[model samples]
Target: MEGTMSESSAPRFRVLMFPWLAHGHISPYLELSKRLSENNFHICFCSTEINLNFIKKSKTFDEISSIELVQLDLPDLPELPPQHHTTRNLPLHLKSTLERAFYMGKANFQNILSTLKPDLLIYDAPQSWISELAALNHIPSVLFIIVAAVNLSFFYHAVNCGIDGTNEAYPFPAIYYRDYETKKMIAMSQESKESLPEDAAFSPKCFELSSFVLVKSWREIEGKYIDHFSFSCGKKVLALNLLNVQDDDTKEEENNSHIMKFLNGKDESSVIYLSFGSEYYLSKEEREEIAHGLELSNANFIWVLRFPVGDSIALEEALPEGFLERVKERGIVVDGWAPQAKILEHPSTGGFLSHCGWGSVTESMYFGVPLLALPMFYDQFLQARLAEDIGVGIEILRGENGQTNREEVAKAIKMVALENEVGELLREKARELSNQMRGGGEGVLHEAIKKLKDLCSKNK
Candidate 1:
């Protein structure tokens, strides 16, 4: 960071940031890069080739003039094609190959670090090995955690607690679901311990090593969790305030897509916006149930439904029979990406049928869109729990075997979107918090930057 006080003669600080190669991680890092660049820091934003291509295509990437895009030349692996550089496009089995390719870039990253000698090195989940490189050269490394603060706090607590796998009452938010049980964590840990590289094993140590922590969430929605995260880590933890969810003037092309046009024609606060995050794809069964639910609710909707990365089947084949024909007048089932921020900000988007990814949750809350959470994987269940606890959304329940039906989904959407009393209450809470969040973000960023600058200057 540059000096706290802006003067023409202030030293230009250089910052290097590398996030995990998933869209969910890269999106926030890019947003942070743009925000930090506003304060006159030059940022080197690093990602693998595939991710860089994706970033290059984003509207925001071109606007970030102060940020230099650095592409990592990952080493080729036996079973992986050149295009399979990121986990997003890779099949489940090739995940290890992806890991191998990631570590192969460490030497190249070392060379870059030596040349840039950045004042601050901020990294996310996958770059844990970079901390030692930064430390050896007297650079201040900060962990820009991209998960919910509650999730971070819980992970830290679980890792340090040294409990047996059978410890059933682990008193964490993640324990809301049976899948997030102690046994599951233990199994996951065992798998990682056996298969993960030594560098990968040290990934969690970034929490212990970094100068401080920066998370994607703010105190407005997760203050207690944030406080616990800081205390648990015994370091400063600051929020970037859901950087991608701001109300600033964005590139019109990004938001003016057909989804927004559809939203434009709907009644105010009447249409439910449905989309899972980019990383996860729903099964055919899941999609049909959701499509049926949307149709049954008689709610106007704009749904961004996607197939698994390279599957090229007709969208109608995956959805319920004649579903599109039945709801075509009132709903538009999008087959690809939608401008999520723009959709949420649209006055017509009343409720979000979400996967409860922290990014999606934050974006919905920031735009005052209540969530109808259908969490499918890690930490999402916890996020859904938080949404319910905050009285901003209702979770769509699942059976003991994690199955959800159309009727249950339909009822949850109606509760969040059309039920007058319940919908109004959630809407009010969401709107109030959204306003408070937008106002609080800049101050938090300013203070965090000031403190980080002081620390970096000392390192210099």
Candidate 2:
């Protein structure tokens, strides 16, 4: 149960939250901040100036009170560099930039803490150095993981590196048999000499440095992965359901609008929604291939194609001969950013051709929109497993050695868009899982906040 504070019982605890500038990271932290604020906790929600300005414009932030939203401005560093602002490079740049930004943030945050020393500091995982500050202040520093716990199995494997008789080059599998019991494991492939793909942000180094780690996933939704990977960590491995809102009555109306405008009264399951998160983009060839695939599938789609992968989008030239003209009546090509959550809620949107980012995955499951997982890099391969193995969505097979072809894309699209065998089952599972996400979700957040509070109160 969420605790209520009386004027006399209010603990006057201060909490600081630092999120990476990207929307994906910022949104989840914001949700936690809002909940904490309602419990009378003072919060400093920190992000770069550009993102703060974007939030100022968005309706999401308009009604926010209680929590003090702090904009940590970097006049020298813009959101992205001039030439290489593609989604693949932005995260790398943001991570690098934060090394400097972190210092500035610390100065500002410390100044605030001096007047009122915080009882707790809740930071995103990447903000590792904050743990030292918390230790010095004798406050509790809890690391908040934005991704799923299954993804953190990579970090756990890294921590046991070269332990016992294991080799450093080949880290121990999370799975192992102990003296009296068998250690469970998240089924991740062993790391090899193969380099990480461009989009991967989490690293083993991150896990080694932190004392506490918490990821956003629920045992009810991801019971296998949680039971296997997190059983050893105990309270250190917290499993919380992601918070999202979707209403069936509202969704039914939205679906009707989608079909009336785009699909000519076709069934709700006939249309597909395509998105590559906020960071990814398609090359002209890849875009054309996708366009061709959708056309071949004879499926209506809402494709959110931003600027080309590396440069300005010459959309007309990049498209196949008269492709735009042919699909104008049959498809909705959003050439720039689309309101993704809104689009996903539409009834006509039966499946998602997603990049498999955690935020996208959570959103899909929350809306009961089954996915045709198309992971490009990062933790996406692991994310794809949640859908495929866990039975909430169907995983599309890339070509040999995890490659893709236009034909394969077409087949996958048809399978999901038409509510084919796997699609129907995944859809049913998604609805079942989403129901749990909305219910048990608040209990988890309430428990986390209280746990952090108790840790502070005990030590204070």
Candidate 3:
């Protein structure tokens, strides 16, 4: 079956996009789908129903009729139900179970392939079997890595050189993880290994099987790392140059007036926007330290707090006692969700107190908001370092034992947001990057689309 033909009688490449069951992964895939749909590609975006529902509700897709949503159903296990199919509010322990369930849905996904018979497949890196599945149907597959190129390069280096090898240090020294973080990463890696099947394909295998790789970054910020990653992987690594910025959702804007109102009242470059992304939950100690730090920073701020799926902890109870009353005048503590892009783009948003998630980092950079980085896990540490290395942010280094220090948090916030030399320099650099990133990416994106077309044409 030849895919859908455009009005001009040209065959529009039908591409199946399967991202891992995480908001971070799914969101970029959707954005990529939108981009491709505009350039004569029909996209079948496949994910669990729960995730697809969120995408369906997004206003970004309202006009993009070429992008179709396809649901990949996972078997409902006792602990893993339809509601828990996504990683949004999922507990850390159930993460492995979700992966297992995702893998178990292979047959269902295979059926989807049989029905769609797409020209190409673009899949997330975690589910390495996706490439194999696509190959089985003679479909070309590309690995879409949502993480930063620096992180991928670091991991590739570590894996190739052995993490414990003293003979070879990572090529980039600025992006090294702390001792405690290293320990945590090792433990998590071991846990993942024990939980998943022994034959499960990882990054190396995924790179091997893919026709090419798509990284969610641009050349300006990570040219060296992108080049390094390509050399390491021995595959054509194409930068999607997808910043994942969208027009503010009209529905969300109407509901989030209070947040904008709060920002309007603040002075320009005086408020810090605080959010730790959706997946990572803070411990009580971490929460209290941050609350106290916010109090100490004395900067006007909008802090968004989120809890796990089943947790019913109240806002007052979760924060430090008297913290709300103390900072009420200068700060607004939002529960659950907020319009992040809107807040970042606002004039009052001076610094982003972020977990250094790639999505958050890119958004922050796009808006020229300097970062007060507080990275928690995974590639976040590297992303935080990248922001600092690029002169766009400052990392709040933890204690030697890896404990969050309130004073350090406050110091970094003041340093990044306040009108000091350091803050001024960071903000200027951020604006410079924002200008570059905004004006750039068109050439890269066009080249990437051309490559996709070439790949699909060859398969045909």
Candidate 4:
């Protein structure tokens, strides 16, 4: 259902949705924008020129006619190369350069808002400077997290520590890092076997400081997460879950199309889906190791290799003798990219060998597919933790030096794809969670839109 303020209410409020360029961030922001538009709020969705180009290519802008798409032209920073469009391709130097650009972008954004005068601004958590910009202009702003509440809680409560303005103030353990058992916790986390609570509640102060702090989770799948947050807020803060739940037939049709093309019937239920997300590119050696492992296992697989192998590192040369010829009929290696969600939802897809990106995990869970998480870095590590904790996945063993070998790779693939007992349990858990997540999403959305309408009415 479309969200709306009361009919009697006049349309006065304008909203600006400024999301980071990644699809993981952009999709959720778009979903929220759609709900806001139904309330008759004037909306402008902003993106950098590069991201806008991507949206154009995907026809995402065309899907939402009511919300105007605005592409911001970034000035030529002397530090950045002109061709650096996709953030995924950039190295650490370019990332630092981009952070500086974002600060400047905030100033440019303020200038644009001077004329447009949006009543509020909503941005991803990384854009903390945007909050300062909004405060300067007397506009209310909120931080929208694309991650689950449990992860956010860990960041705020566990990982971070600060000393007070007075040097005399002692460093007390934060809410997230409670109970003072630090060394043991650290060791356990390293083992990759420990499990934290499946969920966590939002903090009271987080709600008190913001007009709304939007999180991308629903009550059904995360009842404990929701219950913890709800009680802490005392019903004062609004919790919204924006998810586009796909119906059975629609999911099946999309999945089937991808599956048929990829599989072409080499071996039934033998194909594994391998995608490590856009940002995490495997080195040439690692890629070779993976290729060798897949061939050794003799399993049919589709691997999404985003980066091309260097001229000196040809995949064919790297493979074991007669490996390519043997598995040529068994495996399909897709270069650059693939429609991840569609492939994950396919009936022929037995398991996912993923980078453990939250969007990837969510898609896998929604379709009830089991996982073999190969987290390389960043939030992926945390996602791996959640996946294992939730009993929906098993972590692929990376060596002490944070590397994967041919033997480990072969074993992990076999475990998730061929092992009946483990895969069955995982599929069952995933299905249960999937239903809860999609089921609670609607109720949460309805309540959020209502609260938004009420707030809009009060402003009038």
Among these predictions, the greatest lDDT belongs to 3
Per-residue lDDT, model 3, residue 4, is 71
lDDT of each: 0.78, 0.63, 0.86, 0.63
- Among residues 3 or more apart in sequence or in different chains, the pairs in candidate 4 whose N, CA or C atoms overlap within 3 Å are 157-176
Candidate 4 structure, TM-score to reference: 0.79
lDDT of 2 by residue, 16-52 (tens): 7766556677777776776677777777766665666
Candidate 3 residue pairs in clash (backbone atoms < 3 Å): none
Off by over 4 Å in 2: 1-8, 73-116, 125-127, 158-212, 227-235, 244-260, 308-311, 400-402
lDDT of 1: 0.78
lDDT of 3 by residue, 259-298 (tens): 9999899888889999999899999999999999988888
- Candidate 1 regions exceeding 4 Å error are 1-6, 162-175, 180-190, 246-258
**TM-score top scorer:** 3
Instruction: Candidate 2: give its CA RMSD in angstroms.
Output: 7.1
lDDT of 4: 0.63
Between candidates 2 and 3, the one scoring higher on lDDT is 3
The model with the greater lDDT, 1 or 4, is: 1
